[model samples]
Target: MPRKFYDGPQRDKPRENCAIFGVACDDIGYSVSKLLYSGLIALQHRGQEATGISLLETGGNIYTYKRKGLVSKVLNNRVLSKLWGNVGIGHNRYATTGAKEYSSSYYLQPFHFKNNEIEFSLAFNGTIPNYAELMKKLEDMGRVFVTNTDTEVIAQLIASLSIGTEDWPEILRLTSKFLDGSYAIIILTSEGDIYAMRDPLGFKPLCIGELKTGKRNLYFVSSESCGIDAVDGKFLRDVKPGEIIHISHQKDIHSEMVLRTNKTAICQFEYIYFARPDSIIDGVSVVEARMRLGMYLAKKDPILKNSEITDNAIVVPVPDSGRSVAVGYAKEAKLPYIEGLMKNRYIWRTFIMPGQNRRKAAVKEKLNPIKSVIEGKDIILLDDSIVRGTTMRQIVQLLKERGGAKRVHLRISCPPIISPCYMGIDFPTKSELIAAKFYNKYGDSYIEEIRKHIGADSLLYQTKEDLSRAITKSENELCRACLTGIYPLKSVEKIREIEDSIAKSRT
Candidate 1:
């Protein structure tokens, strides 16, 4: 097995960060900041390391505050009251920086840029994998930068070139040309405009909505629909990938959909792990997708085949991400839903834990089986996806020994992730993935081999067809690259070569 930093007998691979949110308004009377807090809390699963909000008041002034903590801990009523504005954008971040300093810096997001002439702050949901190349381009142009964020990269690009142009579309066009990786950003400025744009691939999620007061309603944009629902906003639909939305009090609302490339490559992990269960992305309900995933797995895996999974079998979910899927599975498979795992609400995200050992310790402390819920019952364990089997194995052992489960049937809501994502998600390379490792050693397919190794009675996984069908839109409208290996952009030949060899895939 390819050893990872957090792989001991009881350790598991680290969890990936997820989630992003943005909101804007025209009037100053509303508690827009509090509204933003509600939205961020609902979208917290997308990211937990840091939470931030940026506001642009009516008087051409922008204020922003962000740090390494949860949304509630970082911003309270006192903090929100200090920054007064009708227009704002917020972000919850997952870490991409390898260093502890990079992870700990409060200066990371809603990354603000100011000069004698202009000022702006931005919060983004996706990654720009070619940020190194973009930084070189900016440095060549004499634009100085303070932080190591792709959010900063775009801010500098905008600050340097926005000289004579009052046009937001032109600014976006100039910036998008230099970026070769995924980015979905919200830009707030001294000029009272908030700009939201998804990359050409739609590798991140962004949506539009309206919030109603007594008389008139206000318009806004966000990464997920639940954020809008937090402030009593009704969802309109997803912002088209490769489109930019410009919102302001005075100017006519502006929108433009010009792509750096023609193809759209939305992230499959969003449907499987990132987005909130209540919110729909790209017209697909995340809750429904998870339900379908369980049903599909039931049809494919031997453990579920011909087994009378009635009210006797207890369905338990890995909390937060797996909750809705567990509910759906329990309902559809005619099983009893049991809240068996008790998550430590006090535990910080893996990104916030000071070291690798702390994160590994957290996985143990974060979940424990409720002995009463699983005593002497067959347990079907549901999780969003299993990265390395170490955590799953530990979790299963807990069910068998501590909770007295008769048998453990493992269920995953997504297909075996045979490839790493180059866009925004932070999954490790395939060499470290358990499914890939099992396939390599056994010289066979992954499903059965992984089940046997994990000590599960049987295992079931969602298929590419189930993933696609789970989305209401046509198959062509979604991105299944991680499962299908159909990358929509240019690949470093060596990385792709290694990925193909490890998966033993023909492509």
Candidate 2:
């Protein structure tokens, strides 16, 4: 039997994959590490476990520096000064179930792969459901493995295909055919070129930008537009689905549409919770989408139509994650929006602390209610989503016991997540999700059961159709697999089936 490791308390929401940023400058005199640091800092919310950068030096040598820590602590001035290069790529990792054991520097990115035949550094954001199959094929062809990471499999596949030709776009096109899941990858090669590509379905966000200073032009590829903005670069546009973009010191920007599909399944959670509010992904503003979600929730709210509930109701957001939705809800519902909670910024990553009692105390340490504003009022609490129901239950208890609220009505911006996600987000097994468990037991009564479990007077969730309308994207253009239990990739669907059988056997 293999040893299994589990972290602290289950996180409240799904975790994003990783953050990737790449830069190419026209002059070798300009150092790119500081710029990479700034860009990665802007995307720190996506991942915070580890940070690393691989730079291409003047002599076509790839230099890598990575460690387990936040970007600021890992790539300070002293360290950035030593990594001199004109082109480079950086990564911030978010640990997943498959990567929990391999959290060392060896499993971190930018994963530098060098051999007698080729050398390149890769930074990636996403999951490969069929990576095990690909690994088996590679191993049969005489490739040794060091870690059980999809990133390593991806690098080895690209290296194997490079034997035929050095055309980056063509190589990636071949690579895409074998990979089945979400991915936005950037590679810095010894040939002094950077290749960035998005998966055919555009399941993750990737964008390109340009900056000019003192007659020198620099190009960048980042997981989000906010990253480009952080580096004082112009946000050109999003990297198209199945598009391979090549950036070189001597050239402007070259792109090719290697793959095409009638519909693209951009992750809907990016707008709901994952991305920064200021980010523009696939030409849609994240903040605006969230506002629309709240507005839609208010438009259909039956409680708002009741004069008694509306008389003393005050909208209170759960904190930063619920602020935008609460704003829209307040405006649409004609209610007063109050900052009823004060957040202690210093308290974060509370789950990492051992013991259930410690975790419970950490929540109160993280947020305290403003008793004066919320006391003796109908509190309308807004949050992004509910994962395992533990944290939300605690929060509802805090508001009533500590703040003296008469009644609490909870509104969620996203639909219930009833299935595990395989394309980057961290919920892997159906047994761990609150909604999945309730839905399997009570079916259509799951929402009522969840509301009762959390001790809320009423609970309302955003409908799947309304969520799509809020994002201004068609249902076919978004990935709602977590909500619908239908995956976009065949490989992911197969994995879900296998897990379902194992779960059934346990019952």
Candidate 3:
């Protein structure tokens, strides 16, 4: 059987950094390895490039297994059987740092660090914006670096701090002061304890869940609640921003607020695209938030209200991610919701494919028009968002030419992604964004210009206000940096450096 759930390459989607899962149980009766496997499976969508797990046995021994493959491929029955323990942590990695071409395995994580005093393994999700600076500081302190990843830098920092103190939470608090990025990390120590920490800004999501088995209790910490749900655990709540949760071997869970800030900057992309629709993060349902975005878009559409389009006009989802939004839009617009495009379950995500030719070919094989549903109809095509616009352009062409659609109108669920995401998302430079390019070329008429470029009769996006409202938060509380060009972190200099580098590459 193939390891991947979806075969075709992804189209116009931002890649997430990674997913982290950790669990601590009262006894060895439960298979902690198997539970970690289940949790990683639920988070497999967050990353597919690499998977790992670290287990702490009863006798203060820690074993780690990791490789460059999907979770399904890396953790087979034979592999899980060897990882016997009551406490463990797992990771699914999508590289946001380190060169993929140079010894990639060195960067694959559930990174283990050991010294005469302590031993611990870490699984991290999110990027460290000040990675070079911190790594240099550690290097100055005589720390030997093996891998080029920020995960290793963090592990070494913790090890250096553990020398003089046993208070892991205090060490983490001090570590937090030097870090400037988004991160949710799980640490599994040789003492059979697990520690989960989220960044001060709450740029990433982490949640806790509980499983009660008669006389025993099991605790889980994961990047998303869906990981807990996969193991049949009950979700307790999200770990507060800048909180350090320590789950001891005795099944005691304690939390410390190491860093306190007046505001949080949770990545809006989680609700827009990164997370599973079934998962809830920070007290909001991702699916419900997207549905609200569609409703808002439908309510504000002047064309829909004026009934200017043909009577046969229909709402068609781009498939998968766009399905919920299309349903919501159809409900509000009083139009029929139809699956006009059929996706091939066997094709791999196009974005992960190596070459442009291969990616294009995969896209062609991945989706085919449902002629009966789309022929002779005007399509209100709903998609999550457009990144480079290559996929959307091809999709628009396919719908109009092959599906025989009279006209196509594009509705995007979020505002124009005019800037790059600096947290953990893959859009590192504005030059790679179609919206940014269009805005540069067309000035005030970028929307209309992008519509023409995509061969759509009309193009509309959810306003910034609607997007914030749909997520049940004010714009000030969310990370609208990608859309508004306002970064929440003190990394404006780094953003400019990246933009400058990208411009140089293009020239």
Error of 3 at 442 (Å): 1.3
In the predicted model 1, the residue pairs found to clash are 18-46, 18-47, 19-46
* Candidate with more favorable, higher lDDT: 1 or 3: 3
Best by the TM-score measure: 2
lDDT per residue as tens, model 2, 420-482: 787877663666688999988999999999999999999999999999999999988999999
Per-residue lDDT of model 3, residues 1-507, tens digit only: 001112223336777878999999997666599999999999999988889998987677898889988898899988888888888999998654434342356577788888788799999888887787788999998988887677888898888878888888888888888788888999998878888999988989999998987877889999999999999999999998899999875957789665778888989989988899999999999999989989999999877854658377899998887888998899999999999999998877655565567766767788898889898888999998988788888888889788998889899998999987777677635666889989999999999888888889889999999999999987656888889888888864576677689878998
Model 1 residue runs over 4 Å out of place are 1-20, 28-31, 98-106, 251-254, 258-262, 304-312, 347-364, 473-475, 491-507
Off by over 4 Å in 2: 1-9, 97-101, 352-355
Clashing pairs in 3: 7-347, 7-348, 8-347, 8-348, 8-349, 9-348, 9-349, 9-350, 10-349, 10-350
Per-candidate Cα lDDT values, in order, are: 0.71, 0.89, 0.84
RMSD of 1: 4.5
Which is superior by lDDT, 2 or 3?
2
- Candidate achieving the largest lDDT: 2
In order of lDDT, best first, we have 2, 3, 1
lDDT of 1 by residue, 1-507 (tens): 001112122223334344556566655565477777888888787777788888876566788888888899988878887867777778887655446557644445777778886788878766665675677888998888666666677788887778877677788877877766677788887777778888877878888888666654467777889888887888888888888887664553467655645557777777777777787888788778777766665556554454564445888887876787787777777677888988888875432444446654666777778988788878888888877676677678778877788888888887777666666666666666787677678766677888877888878887777777666554566767666666666633344766568667654
